[model samples]
Target chain A: MHISSTEVDYIALGASSDFRADGRHAFEFRDVIVESHLVPSVSGSSRAQVGGTDVLVYVKAELGPAQGKNGTEGVITFTAHYSSVTGLDNEVRTSNMLNAELEESLNRLFSEKQAANLERLCLLEGRVAWTLLVDVTVLKADGNVLDVASFAVRNALLSTLVPHVEVIRGEEGEADEIEVDDEPASRRLLLEGDPPVFISVCLLGSKWMLDASQDEEASMTSKLSVGVNSSGKVCGIVKAGEGALEWDGLGDTLKTAANMGVKIIEGLRKVQASRAETVGFFA
Target chain B: MGLREFDYGPLVSVERGTEVTTRERKRQWNELRPLFMRTRMVSHAAGSSYLEAENSKVICSVNGPLANTGGRTEAIERAKISCYISRTKFCGLEDDELEKRATTEYEGIVCRALESIVRVEQYPKSTIEVHVLVIEDDGSTLSAAITCACLALADAKIELRELMACCSVVNANGQLLLDPTLDEEKEASGSVLVSYLATSGKVSTVFQTGQLAYDEMAQAVELTISGAREIAVLVRNCLRQRESKDRGL
Candidate 1:
């Protein structure tokens, strides 16, 4: 999508005046609707819609041999795929770039933040463990896809049920037998507090705005994607766009993003708890 | 392929924290490793530089103001900046595929950082290519790549706002280690890389990973900026030295 010079100037002017095209304040976020446990086949699944952007996440757990020398912990990997109808005007190159960016961001968020305790997935030390494969699909792309994807991923992981594994000790040179219970009721993925969520803040002219729309993104100066958890801590940060940010504005942007991220996480948790029925894709 | 045919093993193994204690004893928490950098190392390229921060060694070369070959004819405004970063086989202890992926990710990061410093508007409808190769890697390769690329761009005589100086800080346990080594980086809970322009007191890029408190993040940024300032002085001195040599001083 291409915007004219007049459009960019108009967006900037409105942002500077604390007004947005969608009748939202500079710091206001679009209404986000989250639905979890929609896919029965997958271990966990969720869908998040932020305004026009829609994202689906599925978490699948597979039993595999433990990785690394200290193989007492499980592993989680993230991969993102862009559906053909998503965005970039169906350009393959840009879609591939976006896919790589989202995957890298998600992997870094989970691995570096240590949001979920992987020790809980370990069955036998240096032998067997659970490998969580998180696949994220962008059904629609308006804007703020990374933030929405993070939300869906966190919810999907939260709803994931790991089966209980019993390790029977061997007697006198016998191999230890591993047995996994296939019951539907299982333990939840142990998390360290609330998992971190990414909040992308765009610098529009002199003012910084949260949750920018696609039009706003096209006209924005720069963007900062900050990963913030419920405890008001930063997990990761990535800067995009060609524009430069002033030194004085960096601290303010980070602080505002952290505060907003915490609020969003709390709000989403409330929504998740209150959700009783599956809000399917069409509904 | 059979079920579970491929097992992508982890890069590093959990080790007893004993060796790290000894390593920490040798280097102060906030101390930086020795820095050795030189420009004009590659005669064939427009500009080139090699940077060695203790065990991490990086060579960067800058070429072009070449024609914009991206095929996007929609009225070019500023020159496009492109960066490619790769590591040699013997660079470090990482898998080949993983290293390639890492380099691809860093390509965007290094490109953006340079774009902020380079006066791209001066060369419209053109492209500037920066190629960085890691000859060796012990730790802090990303910071080394950025710093080296800046020197190469300057050597190429590209117009710029100010040279970018970058530094990395790793938060190990509760302590902040400046310019951490590979082992230290592996054991770190979080790390922050800041690319700064000391002249304008503005930061071009800030990439952070791992979990950190708000206060810790702020402190790390401040610390990284100061470290970058130190590197900026060294970079300036090196450039001055080159100028003196060219003038036969």
Candidate 2:
């Protein structure tokens, strides 16, 4: 759809009334359906869909030997690939641009101190650590995909179960030996800490809606993705798109983001509970 | 997702009577790898094509006839052609640095072959950007990329002096192999790459290295051109089908 000037006006007008073309409220989120442990070869994996957007998240943990001054810290790497299946509008150039932005945003969202606690992932303090490799693939395209991708990644990481490794030696003139436990269920990760959920709020005209669909994204100017954990603390906030936010409008947006983030986290937790009771569609 | 490895079967033994069966269809020793070609796969690119041969796949996208470079306009009377090939990390073969070098090498090969065929003189001071990503690399990756990029340019409807395609050959010991798989490639004594333009039947580019006898080199070159001829037919079919489909739509 070539968004003409009149359609832009109509979108703005609709947002002012807190109504979208899909009849969603200004802050109501699209239903997110997630299937975890789909890619069994990986440590953990999930395929998530929100509206038309679909993303596959895969998380693999590797034992990383300590390096440099930050030997005690673990690492997290985010790599995003866009399949040509991202619908009609995403050409290679646009896809590349979106890919670079997604990588940076995801890296910022999980690699920093405010986001995930890497220290917990460290195995031997300064000697060894578990480096989590998070790969997100866009299987489909819709607006608000970045937000949905973060959700899928969070779920995948939560379900990831690493092998319990025991380190012995470096004392009594013996070399160190790191051995992984044979038990499959050992070392379940406690992801409920600071690994937050991201909520993307799209600012159209007089309204900022949560989880904007592809149609809703056309006229929206600014998009603010806020990451918040269950403790109700803000972790990261990234503002993108061509739109800007005024000082007063920014605070109100943050407040809305914080409230919606909690709701999303709660919703995701309930899904996790149900998943434990039975094998998902993909086992 | 995790550590991914491809089974290359067994390497072609030099003592195996100069002929070995491939993993796919039971064809002659001179047979080409399986080819699947399609264009206009990318919605955003001016023209796009995806090519898969055996285990190797490359996606190519063309984005120009776009105006002038960032700055510094060299007074060339032809379109400034550039290529950037990225070997995606998830293929899970080599490390980051090695994969980066492989990408750069393929990008150079692709640029050279395409520059020879693209009608660059028609769009002076403009640029036609060709970007290729290797989804998988079994063997002959550069040849696959060059072939894929040329298909994309044709798909974009760029005026071309001649339509082009490519083929790779390897000389394993005394035996010559067409479209060698990764296992065959590793055990080969030398490799040859040849790109051809359909109209002229002329060699647009030929890349050869490693120790080889004069006759071996000549025979490999001939085999590559003939192999590329087969691939060129596939490219033509892809472009024709896409054109008819667009008109239908």
Residue range A1-283, candidate 1, lDDT tens digits: 6778899999999999998988998888899899987998988899999999999999999998876448877888888988877765655425346677888888889754367667766788888888889999999888888999999998888777667777999898987879888764544543434679999999888888999998988898778899999988899888877666665557877888999999989987886666533354643
Q: Candidate 2's residue-wise lDDT over B56-135, tens digit each?
A: 98889999989985545243577877788777776536684353243433454577678778877798889899988888
Judging by TM-score against the true structure, name the best candidate.
1
Q: Write the per-residue lDDT of candidate 2 for residues A1-283, one digit (tens) a residue.
A: 2466688888888998887888888888878898898987888888889999999999998888753246777788888877777873544425354676676567666665435666777667578888889999998878888888988987887777778788876787876778889676555653544467778888788688888887678787667676666655555545554332342335566677777877888888887777654343643
DockQ of 2: 0.01
lDDT of 2 at A220: 79
Q: In model 2 chain A, where is the ten-residue run with the lowest total lDDT?
A: A241-250
User: Candidate 1 chain A, which ten residues in sequence have the lowest lDDT sum?
Assistant: A184-193
| Candidate 1, position A198, lDDT | 97
**Would you list the C-alpha lDDT of every candidate in the order shown?**
0.81, 0.72
Candidate 2 colliding pairs: A91-B44
